[model samples]
Target: MQTQRSFAKQTTGTLYLVPTPIGNLDDMTFRSIKVLQQVDLIAAEDTRNTQRLLKHFQITTRQISFHEHNTQARLPQLIATLNAGQSLAQVSDAGMPSISDPGKELVIAAIKHGIPVVPLPGANAGLTALIASGLAPQPFYFYGFLPRKTQQQVAALAPLKNRTETLIFYEAPHRLLKTLASLSLAFGEDRQIVLARELTKKYESFLRGTLAEAKAWFDQHQPRGEFVLLIAGNPYPQTRADAYQHLNLHDYVAQLVTEGHPAKTAIKMVAKQRQVAKQEVYRAYHQF
Candidate 1:
């Protein structure tokens, strides 16, 4: 495990994870602004968008474009700058640097190279929406931006259907209605949900109700602005109704084989149901 002493003096320059405002410009923190001005270079997800933020705050520090498309090519250069004792601040269009943002890979590389990473607390849409969401706050699972396709999104939400902790998700305005409908189908119609939109901005609003109500509301109104979807966790006790629930790993595969499934197919199914690595299941099934 890698440990980071954020404030400790380091031989190489520190990588500051600065959080910009999610909506309101006044939400920018003093420390975040200070770091932005002091850093040698700022790596931003969108240069044009970040430029507007920089202009508003009068921060003239040079910015390099470091987004999903260009991360691979830009990573080495950023690392080299850090090694040269030139501090860098990484920022997304809004919120924290790496929460569904474009700084995780770079952060990993920095840590692997023994560079210190310092994160500053600021505006986060997920947490901001959660506190006011009237849902359980602790033990929340931040699942930012689910897959866009309907089938993929449903498959993704299937596993999370049983989680007890509050769930947070981010989605664009265009997909809000479709996502709410999908959430309704996955978690059922009665599940409680809170939709926080345009957070910290003048038009900030929250729509709190059941999943069914949310779907119906968006069906009537055209969704505008970004959304923070806070879903109440599963309230019912988890059921143990699987057909293979009582079977041992080996026996489970054996039973599937007995039922006319190919050995390889049975092994794969067992691995999926048990949530173990396929290789582990394959080894046990073949050897025993």
Candidate 2:
């Protein structure tokens, strides 16, 4: 952790970046509650949202409104608060602040002035989705949210279409199907996808399939809530696709296992790389 020297000029207080729950109030951390109560000030993306959290925790700390519209204006005031040795905590409407949320600017400003920034972990929609996505978690990138425009969005995904690392994205409900359609066009029907919607809420759902399958699901059912889209990485180079073409799926998994990966996980790895059904791999394993 980088300790801001300017933080030493004052009594050495921290700017805690707190994570709030996306859905359930019970997910708030005890440490977060304690910090909120003890901090000199709390800056929230939405005062009303934070107010409810505060009310639930019985915290009465003075809160200043800071969000996208007013964040620039509040930067100086927040810096001054930290320089004066007053502890402050920053929160978005939900989840950790500044991760596709507001407060990145404030965090940067604080660092420029040498104010200590501490991140307290709690609920995060991306991590929540990735954990259950059943995709390769290692070597993955977190792309917060994609743009709404069809061409722009397609262009955005074009660069990452062939990355070997798993990719995660946050998306709005109304555009979910459109985004899926664009992905199908950009990555092709065989691209493996995992769609996590309404996470951590009563109507939570998980839809995992090929790009074509996900598009069909989206068309039949109206999406609800914020969504996290996880795409299994594409095998690099057109030549990379040649490995399993002649090997059949089982031999591919077996070869992967011979190299090192466990048989079960290797099957999944091969499935993602080939963008085929795991059942096909299983059948191949037994027949030959």
Candidate 3:
């Protein structure tokens, strides 16, 4: 319930969520540079990595480490700095802070303590890949990364299996093939998906095809660089006949439970398979 007028004059120093170049240095925005230059301190995920960007722009601003390992110890200090009218900018190794990074807690603390939070948009890999992904961009959902374990990844992707909007995900090179196979299992082999890697860099390329083809391609080729995966959403329409065939929501949950699946997990899977809200599925399943 907080409103932030980014440009408004304020007594306390603002907390800036600055986005760094995902791959190309030229993608850094002019406003981001000015904010970084003006801020009292820069809380970077990796000071060593960020130093390269700072060196490129000749920004001599002091930086402090604020990564996943040190967030618990550093969040309070960052909030205190903002309260003291000393502006601080938070940046990840690349792209936006708090997007699978370590700034979400600090930002939340700043907001709770009445400190202004300003976000300067510059470069992000998700949207950068999505626009050129040849998928529907407007109604897209950005899921930062999937679970590492195979079972967990499958469970995490269950609810998203039937979404109408396009889906976005981040994955490392080593796990690319396994993730593609998992996607094929969850969404079927024929679903369309695109893999954009080495984005905005010299070797940047986009691999587009069905999930099966993607799995095959990666099987044959060695994966390299970070990837932004965009997958087409479920296109199948649910029908009343389909509902009857599945023995209704209650019976479906009961059937899943009888087969040894946890009640909560079963409800979620059923909800996803039926293309309905989880809450709706929960209520209907629980209603005796």
Report the number of the highest-lDDT candidate.
1
Best-fitting candidate, measured by TM-score?
3
RMSD of each: 5.3, 12.2, 4.9
Q: In model 2, what lDDT does residue 152 have? A: 85
Q: Evaluate residue 61 in candidate 1 and report its C-alpha lDDT on the 0 to 100 scale.
A: 99
Cα-based TM-score, every candidate: 0.85, 0.79, 0.86
lDDT per residue as tens, model 2, 19-137: 99898888888999988999999999999989998998899999999999997789888898888878999999989898999988988988887778888989999889888889988
By TM-score, the candidates rank as: 3, 1, 2
Give candidate 2's total backbone clashes. Answer: 0
lDDT of 3 by residue, 1-288 (tens): 668787698888899999999999999999999989999999999999999999999999999999999889998888888889999999999999998878899988988988888888888899999999999987989898999999989878866777888999999999988898889988899999999999999999999999999988988899999999999988894443364465888888887786579999999988888888899889988893
**Regions of model 1 farther than 4 Å from truth:** 1-3, 240-288
TM-score of 3: 0.86
**Higher-lDDT candidate of 1 and 2:** 1
Worst 10 residues of 1 by lDDT: 235-244
Sort by lDDT, top down from the best: 1, 3, 2
TM-score: model 1 vs. ground truth: 0.85
TM-score: the better of candidates 1 and 2: 1
- Between candidates 2 and 3, the one scoring higher on TM-score is 3
